[model samples]
Target: MDRYVSVKDIEQAALSLLPKGARDYYKSGATDEQTLAENKLAFQRLRIRPKCLVGVERCDLRTRALGSEVSMPVGISPTAMQRMAHPEGELANARAAQEAGTIFTLSTIATSSIEEVAKAAPTATKWFQLYIYNDREVTRNLVRRAEIAGFKAIALTVDTPLFGIRRADVRNKFTLPPHLRLANFDGHLSTKIQSTDGGSGLNKYVENLFDKSLTWDEVKWLKSITSLPIIAKGVLRGDDAVKAIEAGCSAILVSNHGARQLDGVPASIEALPEIVEAVKGYNVEVYLDGGVLTGTDVFKAIALGAKMVFVGRPALWGLTVGGQAGVKRMLDIFRTELEYTLQIAGTPTIADITRDMVRHESAYSKL
Candidate 1:
């Protein structure tokens, strides 16, 4: 733990701690994983052009999202079955997010129930991540329960009409452990995800239950059901970003579902600038997730116009290492690195981070 100074270090530690099946599920991406690898590489392809001689004073990392102030612009993205990483699961994650003063987005498929997580971290600024099920009533019920639990917003993931073909899961025949269940749907849905002899049980569960017909009209219908702001996640194309705003989404998250949904999509960061351009003056906040691993990555995303950045695998790595404490440490590293980056870049605050501060390395290649 003392030796884990970077997110990558924490990832290696977590991989060592998690079971083979659980680890594969958490780490593997779709088909060939080209998008997954590119998501991280995309960040490196951009070069930061810093300003100098600005009065170096105190740096402020505070930013607002969905009408609430968070200590930093980094938030935890929703991931399912966290107990596979640590016993405390989403409970640890929620507490850490609250303590860090950032948002914690809970998955619709989390091991901890909405009521249970709310009970565990009553004051955490929570956002519920929705996966629209085949039954409209089930989806409605989940949204209502999240509202009742005091979640601040709804991040509706739109990319996964069906689960991606993650070969590792298929090969491993991955299934939720018998001890765990999708706690959110205890009686209302099938909590148990049974293993198939040949393929991933989770994939079968999603195919059987998730509604493939979801479209822009469904987004509008969701808005009618919840007073909380809706954030459309997994949008990569500029056109799709516009449609989300037209459908009354309060924000758009430029993501490729962490490259777990599509193997060939552009990296989320690469998609951010275009989406930001598309939604210009639309009163909609833009955010990004997928392969964000460092403060530099967070800073770069904001420079390109993301209001905030979300991390999924990093938080799970933290939880796997030391539960809540480990998760907090992971966030602390981000904060510390971000503050250093701000100082060196001569950007004193979040607003000071500007588009000119970064250029895609390709722009320099022709020079």
Candidate 2:
């Protein structure tokens, strides 16, 4: 509705619109959902130390990622089976991102094919999120297709060697509705995701198709195969961030798979500073996702050294509510809030968002 001014409002609308099974599959995290709750909560725990008496008339949110100029530091993270939420699915999402001048990452399991999304938003800056399937040829073909279709980068998701145990999906026996298939696979591979008697069909699909033995060497191989920059998503630990750089990754996405693949991992925000510190000398850039729902969250993320902050569920929520226009509204809200935040914090430009602008609440509580 037009009254929906915030992401939470859109999220409520989406939850109300989607079926129980699809809603839960989209919203629920891994076993226990501890990290899931913590992801957002951690942002609340971070206190912003705003400055005063500084002229903040103009605020610029534009930033560059992987050499592409985006209107803002906030971008869309890849989420699967979007048609379950909206008819246009990834196509709408891509168009929305293009309209907002931000990057749109399409999931490997997206309901729309690479060529379809490319055709839908030819000028959009897109990154293809890759799940290294067991079949190397299949994975290579996906990369080749993305490059051919003009996707700028490859975001290799490393956390999901196997799918997480989401109880909601298990209880609902989540499977793609009979009508929807993984459009990316279409004729190139089996589009069918077999329904399971119990548990999520997705978990079974991932378990059977994903390469469990994936290693850093695989990252090297990915670089060798494609000229597009590779971004290693799901990196939390500082050591792992360093290793990703060593593996020839151009960027590191500090994520916990939206807390979907693990029960108790540090929130992406909490893990960001250390990763930023670890990658100091390296040329790699760091981005963050998981629990970035507001412009304040984006501001905090940039202050904490993330070049950009991504939102997965929020984008889906927007898509569910009103297709491309809804997604555009969601991004506009973030941009507006972030501008207000920058004005209040005395930071006029993205580069002005320094570490002193934010502090962990715990640091203050200790005193």
Candidate 3:
């Protein structure tokens, strides 16, 4: 465990250990992946302002997210196909989140079924990520299953109308390993990923199965079917955030599908301020997830008004490196870093982290 002290270390080990098909599929982003690189690069451009001589002692990292008390502002974002990284898969990821006292979001296309994960981490604060399917019954059934399984909220993914053009997946002809299935769906739907002449099999599966003609009305329709709070994921613009709030989303996740769905969008952190400002006084929580690699990255997002931040690849990297223990270690790294950040930066509590604590690097050039 000491050998892998950082998330990047785990990521390197994970990438090296995974098979070519799954490796490329997990790492690659849309088209040229410009946004992928920018997500982290954007964070680097922000500078944190530290304060001193405040008699700082103990720093608290606990906060409330989605009406639940989390150990910290960090949570695990939904990333598909965990079994590709390890044999335990989503089960390991969920258990780690439970141990860390944070939330774990299960993807609609997870390798583990809703019931299986619920039983695995019955006490974990779990949320289910949903993708509206072309088949309305499939969508309803998924929501029902998640509700019955004790998932706390529905993170409705609104970004992926169609899968992005990830060149690596196409080149690798990405398909799930024979042993794994998209466990939530039935027989053929679960096993749809296969090498196709058209390119990435997963892309084809989404195109054929996902609903593309969705509009804001879909949110209302979803609300009608289930009582779980909806979180509008993949929002980048302020207008969309307002619309999400207006259409009854209790929270907004500012993301660009981890830069996998689109290439030219802003980093999730870069897009956080607008959404945060837009949703002010709306009784909505705004979270960001993209290139959150370190505790400073988490601090910057919170200072900029993000209610919480999530990590997708980093958690997967942990899972790949050591399954549940690896994920727990990865989270502990963030927790420790965040605690140190609070104490050193002179913001001893989550509320002390304000907009003034962070400044864009470009802002200093004006002086």
For 43-95, candidate 1 gives per-residue lDDT tens digits of 99989888999987789999999889999999999999999999889999999
What tens-digit string does per-residue lDDT give for candidate 2 at 138-248? 999999999999999999998888988999999988888877889888553444464776788888777678999999999999999999999999999999988888999
For model 2 the local lDDT of residue 206 reads 78
Candidate 1 CA-lDDT value: 0.93
By summed lDDT, the worst window of 10 consecutive residues in model 3 runs over: 190-199
- What candidate 2 gets wrong by more than 4 Å, as runs, is 187-190
User: What are the per-residue Cα lDDT tens digits for candidate 3 across 189-256?
Assistant: 98887446668989988878888899988999999999999999999999999988888899999999
Which stretch of 10 consecutive residues in model 1 shows the poorest summed lDDT? 186-195
Question: What does the lDDT read for residue 58 in candidate 3?
Answer: 72
Clash pairs of candidate 1?
none
